[model samples]
Target: MRRLAVLGGVSIALVAAAACAVSEDVSSPPHEEPEQSIPDADVREVAVGSDAPAPTRGLLCSSDGWCETLLPDPDLVVRDIWPFSDRAFAIAESFTSGIKVLEWTSTDSTWRYIDDNSQNEALAELAVGIWAPSADEVYYAVSPGTIYRGTRPVAPATAWSWSSERLPDNNPANVNHGDATQRRLTLGVWGTGSDDVYAWYSNTIFHRKSEGGGAPAWVPELIADDFDAPDEHIFITGAAGKSPNDVWFAGSRRRGTKEPCDVLVRKTPEGYRRIADGVVPELYSDPCTAREGIPQVVGGPRAWPRKFQSLDGERFFALKSWNNFLRIEPDGDGYSVNIANVPKTLLDAPNLISLWGESEDRLWLGSTFFNSNRGVVVRGSQVWGDGGVYEYSSIALNGAPSNGPPNQIRGTSNTNLWAVGDRYALHKTTP
Candidate 1:
């Protein structure tokens, strides 16, 4: 669910930080590069990808910012932002036929190829994220349920030939893991020599002991039928809570009118149990009211890998709001909910409230309003980015916070945190 850079009047803020070495000026060589056709060399067209273009109708962004239009291809959709090392921009770009990774370096923002593996014409492995069971290499999931991957440092994906590798189930075109399409699989990523993976795609609300696998397993045991995630549109929004035992999976359920939607959360223990729904207002065109298009769940996405608020034993609370915020507390049987409206102290703020997290004591909230998707600054009842009660001190920032804005954030250790999603991924430590 990537927001394609479209034709918009985007506000371009040239943060003269160290990253802009990404500009073509620094990446391109003396004479080997192609002539710049567009005015803004900052924005580059994805030569090969499956991501669909946004509206042909552009927006009036600020002066100079990054934006692009959605193409006519129906299969095209930006899958996920590739993880980064020290000097590379790794990206997962999809195609109607297959998937590929467009890799580039800071020295040259020109994206090259990472993996051009064997393809299955019958089974177009629409690759998603790269998981590391260990550090030796990385593997890309063709999709969530099916786990086909390549070792790290994926190459230009052009060599793939369909009908090559065989699966244990013998199903080449594996899309859904089991008989259940209702279940969205989430990987319990682990590491050995490389990143190993586990899954949760069960028939009933997934119970902890269930088993699943493709490359990563998708247990059908995790989702309960009573949980109420729409059959078709329902998807895993994120796993909220603090620990594995306390984890809660977030699901988006579409109901009644096509556009109007609701968010669902089911506790992931003993099996799935209903926790709450529609914590945030969903966009709906009443049955009688004429609607223009679908109202999107802005900032609503399954917390990217390492993006959820979970530690070994604690599950962080989850919240979302446009004008207000929603928080939940587990009751003996059900759950108690609290609603907080974004105070004026932070309403007119630059970024919109997307996520909030708290440690044992300090509470932190983050926003990415408009296109200013900056790092989540620790804020209280105040605007983030502009200035917040909590500025990241060098000690707090000792963790290599993604040099770029975290499309998603997750904290594992008191001092170790990980953020993924956006073009640049983050692995930071808080001293």
Candidate 2:
């Protein structure tokens, strides 16, 4: 749907309905620091390293003879890209019909897939991770009602040698939180650590430490032991693949009462814990009043800091401004955040810019902290590799033709970087 056409309630209901299962809240040790001691998180990032060349994959391409090939028409739509092993990498592709696992030779840039007809369905939204513990990747195929771990490679899919009982199909919007294909599906997903796996499912959150194989074995735990009780509800929002325990979600309800309306968090071994105490006051004020009051207070939980990610699966960070949180310098010695302080003429929501990164360095990208109206793009520092901040229209597969005022950084990783919703909605960096 176009950004202008998305209805807050309807969109939420459409997605929330199918995802109406899971649960949580987060709690932080109170700091003795003064109220003003908390500093903004946007630090102007500097180019840490150089464009340090990417290992060239010499794979030649067969042209579709359609669009401008020179303009960068790498056929395989890359849903997600990350180091598969020390030398190889994998990109998940969910095209028109089925899903595919493209393993890159990194050296030859020539990547192939385990093409099995049954393997074809919908790959996780390109940006979403296609769990590959070893070489065989693991993913849930909702349309076919199966969860595939990686099959024999043939043409365009993993053609996994096996399949399993499908995950419950409670997704309302048919989207995958990982990529456009499953953005709204709200499939069970989580990270235990760079190597562990996590899944926040109905009433329970499952955790496991394993290399991709057959069924996912996990230690069962309650995301919300009392979610059945009135006032408690959990909905996961942002998560990390590097660390499954670093999962984050939103919920509503007071701890002692069933008032049921609050944001929460749940980590490995941790139960559903409240993350926020109260909604920003500006949310209750009239828009007319809010425009003058503060943009940070207008939206609801939508207004409350909606996305969260692990700062390495241990400490967590949030992009909490409602208007437009601009110019982030994660590596900056002191700079943390820069609110709509950017000149408004070139920007839109000073707070809604998209946020994603792999390391505070390259391997990630963040939306423009300034000029969001025109759209902004910030590259990770060279520390990881390519680092520099640039501005580009936040356009990608499964993305709105345009989602100006509301660009989402998604708070995953640049490698985990992907978008869903439209043909152009699902955006990925490498693939």
Candidate 3:
């Protein structure tokens, strides 16, 4: 096991902002775009299907639509992949081998094991999140309040060196009726650069900043008790921002199974503030505890916004309940919220899961249905400006398997796109 470095403290204040709402009725006709067809020669499956020794489950596509799968070990299950221009990094876990970090380069076209978590069971089994600011630097977050940093090796070294840091454990044993273990689990890690990284677990957010002429250290940015009621718990699922001053973190707040509310908080030049609060009907059957309502759709367990992404910092998109999608833009002092539902005329009962885009008018949403073999990718184009409606169309996956759904959609541009999930990876080179 690696020795853990204790972190220092920093004090930050939270400010409550006035809730603002600008609702738009999206009853207009659904906008549609013509789908492109890829030639048989342009698409191919590498190490997928039942015949391969270890099926490729994780994939990364370069800026030019060149795709590769990450499968260094047969028993690994990849949780996340982060890509750079020429190299990529992934986090995978195995019951027998523990946690593994794999690296791939465009030149080699093969995945290589680059991490050293094999001896530490806790680090191996619990590392779930990864983010690379550059090919030389990366950050991995282990659940239960631990983080690891890896830097590229110099000429004499053959491997990367990793250092560990420990965060303040807010989840002491037996708290919240012994369910505090869930709160200790880190959700993810993200940043604009190497110096401005952020990580959030269940309810707490930590920031990594440099001290007086020494290495950067993680410090508590926000804690649950400072923001929520004694009975309420906040589960941060996703985060994104235009820059350090305009970042946003979102998730759901629950006070038992009966009440689940949507949470949207932002960090500006001033400090952290709660900007929006609404209800998540899919998580609870009882009445909503709506304080200031953001748009929501009524449906099953997948109703809440699971992930958030933005091409530019001014506007953001998130996957919502069923076929519905969320669009958030900067409004006067708050944000303008719009919930766009997939037209029933296009598809029936599609559960949108992943989102990626190149601009406000050009977006791709990935959908997978319950008890179904195939999934669909929907393209959304803005029909107007903020609070306006979006036109959506279905994109066909030519070589992807029937049983696979695009769990994640990412690309450098519309001309070079990739959708990967469920043992399959699909790439599109045409706009």
Candidate 4:
């Protein structure tokens, strides 16, 4: 059930290859000792990661080079994606047809089926996550909790402004682990619009605020009050920021020896701190805490951190434990992590699921290797002398023989990318 994917626009090609060096010594004197600012040439590139080699077969590509499989029923499985501004929204499944929510705007580039009420099968088996923040604000998340808020239709025979409520289970109890008990999973949804939204159940942190500006409500944000104890259990996997007080939330805290460290936090206006705790001890060792390796999965989130932030939230990243990428920054009164390097290591998989871009030199990475069912699509580059590094170059989009396992990836640039899993869906457009 590891499907997750998001936003849109186009034209993105940021390849920063800076090499500047200016020095003046006109004999020497102005204070006499000032000449040691040399730090360049580090074009960051150490990624043949997870051992990239064979690929280029029929060359699967989207973004116009033609890579189509938008469901003509190849057994359907394009779980999540939410591009904007030419519109896109996806969540599809098919065992005999069950979960569906599809759309493509700007007058249909192809892909339809969007009938609401979350297709109700008890809220499509407690929805889980899908966020859109624009193109008429969309959101859906249901579980032993809820939150639905659509608003599309402005034409094409208009009429869609649904809404549902109930969300505040403040850790509604679950976590025993002697014989097992941790099922409360619902772990995503970000914000920056629709009155600053946010949602995260399982380490609780809900908040919405549109106020005198009107409509947008969901509360339960008392962030980090000792973040749950009695043997630990914090879980918030991913969040971004721009407002709602400059945010950032990436998770992991499990302990009681069920092990699962690394949990970074940061939310301002003076609340919630702790930038790095376990900071990723290779994700608590033993190749993701022993037991045949990775998949400590209980109710939700056993996925090792997948993140990316920078839209005025001031840079932060974490592809951690699929073989490290952690970045963090802004150190002067707090924060500084850095641990890059993600290249070749598939069968040794440790989960590096999804991450998007718009910055960090046009980032985007998505991985999955459930023991060689394989999946990868890395293309990140952020190189600038000492203290500015991140370089990855991967391929092997599971579609080797033909498609599946990209999990989720979104784009608004970097050639307007988009990726899906299992039954396939791809679109890269150009560059």
Candidate 5:
């Protein structure tokens, strides 16, 4: 099933449901930075209506920006791509039904499923998220249910065995709250190693440490114990860290009679503590009044900053709805959060599906245009991969054909990127 869309974009239809709209003065700003260059050659006209030429549904392009179809059958919809090593492990759904795992082979330039119909069903199950610390060490979580770990020999060999464990039906986590398929009880899974796996379910986080057993035997532990009480109501969305102790979890809460707010929490050997609240503020605001407002959960599912990832050992990045980009870095014992200035065109887009980066300087953001199949790519860069200052520009997309913006993006480098979504699979091989 497709992962539920995170609420970061401002949809035209959701304007009425907005918490409160107060137009703020857009005159002065906190700090001014150099604006980045836009790749106008890559930007194309929005293909609209039935008369437009059919989009190249499964496209894979090179570093130079030349693209070609990756899948022979246009009916196969690529959902997610986990580019690990020289190979890419992805979840693709065929027209007939079922989300299957597809392994892209660099050797022969082809794609194949991990498990054919006759093999183990555990390998056949669709996963909500995929992560590969290494080619031999890969992990994926099937929402509302289990987490599977797959170890492989290398590419071209599609055969592999997996170890699966059922997620505990613990307290406070309501996996069965909404739609069982689209909105999985489990949001995502990640780890630095097999024994140190972490899974997020609703507002709770579960940890499975290697228990001296062979082949990654995992015993689940309710690691996130210090969540906000029932009064505030916490919802855990995105999580990532360099290690188990050096991790960060992004969540939001609506306190009694108070506005909803998002907070970033960091965990260490000492324990977890609230690092920052109202982390990403509106760009056009008084620095003094920036933290004065709250970020009410707008469109749906937990919202944007709900998703985050570490760009390197020192820096982390996140997104907030209605066009707020965040940059986080280690500052002594805590973290310093900076509100980034995304391209205005991208900020006005309707929906944001995914955010990922190959490095601190080469960041990618995916968003859907208002009422159009076209998605926008905002490639951002900082001053020499270090944080605190940056600039961004949008690359308009063509040939999406109403499938929605690209949902997930992953790459080994900027030139070796892949953006997969509802009905489209785009690849960038060259610079």
Candidate 6:
């Protein structure tokens, strides 16, 4: 198998040497630094509204605590939410049909369905990812690697115009194009700006760059082959970045059902390269065989990373397992990995699947399950001097129904946050 060469003049041997010094064993307890002082946790009020609506379907709340059901249809299962200053956009799946795009503006104070009629039902049903940099521009990704771009029309044209394109299909034999059973589904879409956007499926990362001309088309920027993996496939589950020059993709490499190892690659001005692997010594063993005797990495994440989000591009947080997460940041010329546990005391639920934040000090996480009684959302604040420790607190959802957990959490700022999942959507805004 082929391995990536050294990055930015730093050889992989040198990178490994530097990582060994700071890398924590996943099985061991957190190493405390006695010389470092932990910062005091920030305090904020939990506002309760007098006429708050019951969180039966979902709830929207302000900082002072006024809440109401935010979904236009109670049966819609919101998959993701993108909040803006004057409006917000969401993609939700219904019990009877596939996914639908909805919009809510400050002027209207209501959610409106905005998907194009030209989009076929098959593609619509596969829509799972949505990202909007502004009200005028949005990008949606569907299963089996199809992307749709929607743009608001000028005056005299009240409707938005949409164009669709498909990402390269490596395994076209998988006709189902489903995410769970196949590798065709587009996992997520994100970008620093509308002109430079990105979308990724299982093993390929697609890029669309428009340069002062008509519309540009999505093109394959990177693939699993570029990494020279021992296995035929690498599962890329999430993507995030600070800018066009600095983007990150994370996932795992599996030798069939056994011997799974972490895979992390970053894209810089230089190009894309793998920075770290086999992070947990126990799990990072022999990629060629289904070996059983290899020791498991202790204190490391319970599973491979499935999602990632960055607060400052400097520090990226990844959701690996139900109660465990990872903090990846630059270390010298390369990068280092730090595994941290979620404070069980702070979470009422188990599956913390969604992650978002306004800054390094303030972060938010959401839990998920079909029929969870307590839809939990936890806010984490960094404890200074501690290697990536945080003080976590469960945000109170005063009128929220115990119907289901949140699948996603997003916000424009610390005071304005939104969490949507199952059959509900919750919003927190300034009073």
What's the CA error at residue 92 for candidate 2, in Å?
A: 5.6
Taking all chains together, each candidate's TM-score versus the true structure is 0.44, 0.47, 0.71, 0.29, 0.67, 0.74
Which residue pairs clash in candidate 3?
99-124, 303-321
User: Where is the poorest 10-residue window by lDDT in model 2?
Assistant: 64-73
lDDT of 5 by residue, 1-431 (tens): 11112222422111111122222222212122123211111211111111113344644343336244355345666766788546777766664545555666576556655533211233334447777776666666654445566666445544565555654433343222345333432366777565567776555565666556644443433233332444434446667877766877765543333444555555667655555443222232312112322222222223436347886546776766545556566444333445544554435555656778667766676777664666656566662222424323223244323356666777777667877766555667766
Runs in model 2 deviating more than 4 A are 1-78, 84-95, 115-129, 134-147, 151-165, 169-185, 193-195, 201-204, 208-220, 223-233, 241-262, 268-308, 317-354, 358-376, 380-431
* lDDT computed for candidate 1: 0.33
Candidate 2: how large is its RMSD? Answer: 15.5
lDDT of 2 at 295: 14
In model 5, the runs with Cα more than 4 Å from the true position are 1-66, 116-127, 153-158, 173-186, 212-215, 221-233, 243-245, 254-260, 270-304, 345-347, 383-402
- Superposed by TM-score, candidate 2 places the C-alpha of residue 335 at a distance from the truth, in angstroms, of 18
Model 4 has an lDDT value of 0.52
lDDT tens per residue, model 3, 331-399: 444445555655655656777766776687667777764537566667766622333344433333334
Model 1: weakest 10-residue lDDT segment is 14-23
Q: How does model 2 fare in lDDT? A: 0.33
Order the candidates by TM-score, highest first — what do you get?
6, 3, 5, 2, 1, 4
RMSD of each: 17.7, 15.5, 14.6, 22.9, 14.9, 13.5
Task: Point out the higher-scoring one by TM-score: 2 or 4.
Answer: 2
- Model 4 TM-score, all chains together: 0.29
- What is candidate 1's CA lDDT for residue 392? 30
Question: In terms of TM-score, which candidate is strongest?
Answer: 6
Which residue segments of model 1 deviate by more than 4 Å? 1-145, 148-219, 222-233, 240-247, 256-270, 277-308, 312-315, 322-326, 332-334, 339-366, 369-405, 411-431
lDDT of each: 0.33, 0.33, 0.56, 0.52, 0.51, 0.58
